[model samples]
Target: MFYDHADQQAEAMHPNPDWTTTPITPELIRGALDLETTQHGVLPHRLPARARAQCTDPQLAMVESQPSGVRLLFRTRATTVELDTLPTKRTYQGAPPRPDGVYDLLVDGRLTGQATVTGGNTVTIDMTTGTAEHQPGPPGTLSFTDLPDGIKDIEIWLPHNETTELIALRTDAPVAPMTDRGRKVWLHHGSSISHGSDAASPTNTWPALAAALGGVELINLGLAGSALLDPFTARAIRDTPADLISLKLGINLVNLDLMRLRAFTPAVHGFLDTIREGHPTTPLLVVSPILCPIHEDTPGPGAFDFSALAVGALRFRATGDPAERATGKLTLGVIREELSRIVRQRSADDPHLHYLDGRDLYGERDFAELPLPDELHPDAATHRRIGERFAELAFTTGGPFTGHNA
Candidate 1:
């Protein structure tokens, strides 16, 4: 007997007949701006479909689907829960094999369980040529049994780095959207650091940790390698419902060597302008890049450290000349200076606008103590440090997110 695709998928999801299977729906998800229906299941997207349609770059497409801060939010009395997912795992030709992405399950705001899905699709990337080939695989299930008995809020945080297509949610009891707890909503946008590169788990990402500490609901638009101050991204921020907002700028612009200092200033202005169109008086904070020694003075087009690559390790170094800054070449120093000036100028007429030095989150002192492992992304310990520092700086009494600005 032959089975169709849907039948096979259904069979794969329902291996244990006793559990009540529930279709994953919009209300059950948070942090994702949109969801795309696929043959296997529903894929969450950080950016809306309209924004995605505007660009065909594969990097942007892949990062948005990775669901950096996305999670399933519900309240249930279930003692056991299982979710079927199709994850697209990535691997570079020469580097060490990447670990399976983790799913963090939170019970009533506390981390109670964690699991990783296996046997999903894989994408092999050629680091030298920047080409990628996809190979399909089977779906996998993440099961968490022996949850607490009482009715409690449940949050299953999707992997911060993997492209996960959620297929089904099964539990011993019924579930419903978790009731609001009166927390402020924080919507943040930034580069890979904010996307949780090297973070231990989804809930351990800096934004996630900071949100937890700040007592706010989080909506992370932290697109890896794609926070290029694009108009559509700004529009997405403009349209998203956020009580507090932040934009972490500079790193991606400098590293991609995407523009000159001349183009960079106006791009920052236009991006802020678009956000203010909808969020006219919302508390908006502009954050500059963290201290990256290599790119601090040197212009980029950051390149992989071929020496490290030869030993099967991953590392990056700035490739552009420091002298090129004379011809308007962009560097971290250039971007940070420009961002500070822009925010200061904009804040004159907009009291709600604020500025933050990203170094305050992860500074030179912190770097000396816990340097970036890849010279690009923060490690798990650094993520925790940044999260703690962010909460202290931005969510505390005198911080921008604490009170309304006149």
Candidate 2:
């Protein structure tokens, strides 16, 4: 994914736009819970108010602002559209350079094109050196032209993994906020797997995929390395308007080794309680972590396999001791049991609460065919599998997320 930095910089520095620029407003954005106006441009935040205030951990701050499921939605008659943005690209010192974040264009709900903006900003992390550096680059423009003529709904899904600072939007035809298309809002919260970690594009993320299949508007709170049943995140989810809600729990807890089984239980319960406060009857589905054989029985603090990194690759291995489980440490297996029990106990009174074992989406046999490339996150194909599976299991009739699809 190495780019010709010199060539990209030259293009970024130049100013040539045939289309008229339009000021983007809040109404045109979707999937972002909150947005902050910055000197560079608008910075989208998946977490809002109290949730943001509670996030002091650098990893949480960094990933939540990456705009994983965020997209710009508007109506336009334009034959051409261009978006200028300053995107922060990550480069691991030892691993093969990652690809430039991808921008996907959808006209009237069908993907029409894709492009990558080059050379906006850079963040280099050296695990060996235990240091990170930020090298800022000029803003780059992603242009799509010669679209079908006539009034059309245009959605430009931002890169799910990049910290994109949107500078401006230009279109040949005047643009307006998308009309209320009357879609059920679906708010989904989960770990990096749900954040589209290795998915090829923003729209291809499982949640994005499932949402399209189920015909729901999505507000994805899939924060990488941060879905640890945080109270504020619960509150943020509680406050957001959603007809259907889902909380994908487990992996991040084990990976970070954040709590023992004793504490994890109450945290899950409490997290649900907060969300129930706002939408008591919302069909809330509790999804356990998808099967990661490595963390199924083993506890984590998952660590980057340094040996693999040395060979110019990236791979992860769970480092926590299995014996630690005896001390109430969390594991995917334990979390599933507890999450199911908790949901069952609550469902008697709160019929809206339901449970879905993640293994159903990616169990042992499925893993054999579609193993996690990083030994944790799913690859693009796996994302598609999980997304389709979710749509089948949760978005189908008789499923927790099904009734609200209308």
Candidate 3:
């Protein structure tokens, strides 16, 4: 049962005396590379300090702190759990408002309950101009009651799209960090699609769902609008420990119009080279962009569909001309071809390196059935489809991330 945060005053005035308060610490957090002590609370960060220091873009900073796959993991017998959090929500200036981010609770790996904190902060964005305004507010408490009995592992999956700061944790029973389960740690990097974009909840994100099905611990480095093959991100991935690794490249590169084929090929090569320095023989998969029709033949620097925006809906359209491909501009088609060629060339010497065309996960036929709502990010159902497909292709027998190989 979800205890609504509407009773914020009551919760604050009459704290449950039977509950035990637990301090938020690095040990209790999973999927976050670093935890920063903020004035309000400990904030989980997806990127390490070094990588964050290299970039000055406010968007990257905001997304990294959104904690796409980060969760609080502990073993407990608590039937009631309450978490105090300050969630920074986002709103588009003229587009339809987004719902508050969700917190998914899992007991023994099964999703048990879901809740959302009522109020905290809001970041209003002007999509057309690329500007944002922040409004700070007070924290809210999320409570979950009537949990199943007996000692079990519990995971409080944080909001994937909200910048949440942990303020406090209270439970009826004691809690301890969950011990390693011997599952292979799968580290993945991609664009916002992998960052849980448009997904209903944190655990529902494609990477999260895939990790659950594959029985692998996930460390998602899927930064929204920031997966441009940055050297710092590559270095972060290289230094992180993982039994298997995958990089889903292309979409963000095209949408951002960050580089041409000339710059992209060498950057991709350099990114792989950096990762190989640390994980020389680990099963590494290179995935190209999924089926995005707008950028299939047309180059990008994608723009908002202003017509849709007029109706209070958010949508995107490729703005660059297709003829630009003649000048070595990148289109999804160009990326897919080049990625395949690069992987095939490198695999001759690097037996562990592998490739999967992203279209195989969400292809033209799939797109026809479940078209992308925004011409880019997949919707919740699409996230599930992509996740299931990834597990089947990468974790089953004869796959690069098969038990024997990973």
- Predicted model with the maximum TM-score: 3
- Could you tell me the lDDT of residue 320 within candidate 1? 93
On the 0 to 100 scale, the lDDT of residue 397 in model 3 is 90
Which 10 consecutive positions of candidate 2 have the poorest summed lDDT? 1-10
lDDT of 3 by residue, 1-406 (tens): 8755576634652558877898999889999999999998899999999999999999999999999999999999999888888899999999887888899999999999999888889999998788999999888888888998899999999999999999899999999888888788999999999999999999999999999999999999999988999999999999999999999999988988999999999999999999999999999999998999999999989889999999988899999999999999999999999999999999999999999999999998999999999988999999999999999999999889997333
Best of the candidates, lDDT? 3
Clash count for candidate 1 is 0
lDDT of 1 by residue, 1-406 (tens): 1112333444557656766777888899999999999998899999999999999999999999998899999999988787889999999989989999989988999998888877789999998999999999988777787888989999999999999999889888888887677888899999999999999999999999999999888999998898899999999999998899999999999899999988988999999999999999999999999999989999999988879988989999999999999999988888888888998898889999999989889888999999999899999999999999888888888999886311
> Model 3's lDDT to the true fold?
0.92
Model 2, stretches more than 4 Å misplaced? 1-18
**Global CA lDDT computed for model 2:** 0.88
lDDT of each: 0.90, 0.88, 0.92
Error of 2 at 47 (Å): 1.1
TM-score of each: 0.96, 0.96, 0.98
Candidate with the larger TM-score of 2 and 3? 3
